[model samples]
Target: FNPKLRELILAGKTQTLSPKENELLKMLAEHKNDLLPRERALKKIWGSDTYFNGRSMDVYIAKLRKYLKEDSNIEIVNIHGNGFRLVAP
Candidate 1:
């Protein structure tokens, strides 16, 4: 994934992501194998972690999952009431 280009090259296919998606993915990549607090991501990317913003972040998470699904070894695991972690090689 290239943050500057907002490009994800998966399985030899290229996918372009939205600005927010790029930001969120970049943040997750930074925190790969570590906990990325939901509040932290919301505030950093969405500017605030309101109910609506939290819900919006969820949607983005699902989208990110779709984009990353081509890779069987990578996962965005939910920490259930805490945060998320990017599990990857």
Candidate 2:
């Protein structure tokens, strides 16, 4: 993950990320293997925890999952009504 470039390199391939994508992924990576609270992420990254923003986050999460799909060692676990966990070796 290169925040400067806002891109992710997995399996020798690079996936350029959008601004929100980068921020969300960067936050997740920072908390690698730990829970990143939904409220925290929404507030800090989206500037609000509104329902619409939360839905937007879900979309970003799906995109991130697609980007990381090739790597078996990495997983993004959703904590129901809580947040996300970036599981990686």
Candidate 3:
């Protein structure tokens, strides 16, 4: 894929994402249709796994969902206590 086009597809034309949201989406895109562990997200994005950070990550997840909803092929699914999966198909 073309580098610039890949960035455009990943980032979208709106270009309105918080740093955390951007990182989360980037990770999801990298692992598209695969599980993304909650703990892993916390450690990589929040720098730690704590109650407060967990809630904060949830907020980011919601934001990501809203942003990606325009595309029917894209979905962010919660896997109970396990984590999330970014499904594109």
Quote each prediction's TM-score. Answer: 0.92, 0.92, 0.78
List the candidate 1 regions with Cα displacement exceeding 4 Å: 48-52
Distance from true position, residue 88, model 2, in Å?
A: 0.4
Instruction: Write down the lDDT that model 3 would get.
Output: 0.73
Candidate 1: residue 44 lDDT (0-100):
84
Write candidate 2's Cα lDDT for 6-86 as tens digits. 989999999999998999999999999999999898888878435464777899999999999989889899999889999
List the pairs of residues colliding in candidate 3. none
TM-score, structure 3 vs. true: 0.78
Error of 1 at 23 (Å): 0.7
lDDT of 3 by residue, 1-89 (tens): 12233332334545456667777887877778999998887788778435454766888889878767766778899999988999987
Score each candidate by Cα lDDT: 0.90, 0.91, 0.73
Per-residue CA lDDT of candidate 1, range 1-89, in tens? 99999999999999999999999999999999999999898888878435464766788999999989999899899999988899999
RMSD to the hidden true structure, all candidates: 1.7, 1.7, 3.9
